[model samples]
Target: MALISPFLPPGTINNVPQPVLTAKTLSLRPWTAGDTPVVFAAHKDPAIALWHRRRIEGLEESQAVIAQWAGQWEKESGASWAVCDGKGLVVGRAALSRINLFEGDGEVGYWTLPTARGRGIASQAVTALREWAFDAVGLKRLQLTHSTRNKASCRIAAKTGFAFEGIKRSALRHEDGWHDMHLHAAVSATPSG
Candidate 1:
């Protein structure tokens, strides 16, 4: 009998594998419609809009963003988890976007609610997701790029063991102008079992 299931092309999965990750003080689960309100609240933080480069208008737009995230998971292109507190309030978000299964690569990003900042929650979520991406999703490498000005994100990346790779010049544009992106990456040292 074959140990592996029938192998399909990497990017062809119809739905993302929803996995719940637990940490010292966080619950990371797939985003759902019920999370729209909390997502809106957290996203309303001015820093979120500034760093993430998008404005969330209200619950309606928040719902749309969640739907879009689901759609991306279905297309095997992206996935996000709502980072929740012990009380189940969404305090942040962690996501792997621009997933190229064919290339065995993906990009990671994260943010925390204003209230959740300074708790080391982003780094914990990133650590959990990194293990999932490498061992469970069987991805070979994960990358993260943030505006050079976002020192907080750089700190989280370092804390989570994503080695500093380099920077992309003026690779992303924001409300102000183009910004350089600092790149960091984590590669699996062991071959996929």
Candidate 2:
């Protein structure tokens, strides 16, 4: 057997600072300690906590999480951005995790503040993140998965061009129990006409 060469060379993402991405009404920027309040509040929202299956106990923990998100860029394992509205209010989050540079693939995830829901914030942020993952980061594919019951996430995946692949049986565990997950994916290539 022969060793497979990496699709994207090491340092493709970690070599430079993560760039801020913009959508029509959103800006996805690196997370920082200044976002502690919003992060803490978002984690406490019932809807967010239910879907994300975690809670921030305090501002200190939120700040630590923000710092960890920032550090992931240097580690090249993942990246996260705070999705801000035009006036600079943090409304959501967008991220790429489980990045495998060798395979040029990663997983995508996002969540919007309860107050910011139904305004297309998640869709816009995911779109921007997808573009950056493929074009700038040189990823070949991005996968998105959400609980089958998460209709909003399903819609966001569709709107962001992640084609539905299939369902994974009891793939993720939440507070209630394991839940079936819908898997969606988008590749960086377009068919030639």
Each prediction's Cα RMSD? Answer: 4.1, 2.2
Checking candidate 2 for backbone clashes, the offending pairs are none
Top candidate on lDDT is: 2
After best superposition, candidate 1 residue 115: deviation in angstroms?
A: 0.3
Give a tens-digit lDDT track for model 2, residues 1-193. 7477888889999899989999989999998888999999999998888888999999999999998998889989999999999999999999999999988899998999888999999999999999998878878899999999999999999999999999999999999899999999999994211
Q: Give the TM-scores of the predictions, in the order they appear.
A: 0.90, 0.96
Error of 2 at 59 (Å): 0.8
Which pairs clash in model 1? Answer: none
Clashes of each: 0, 0
Top TM-score prediction, candidate number:
2
Worst 10 residues of 1 by lDDT: 6-15
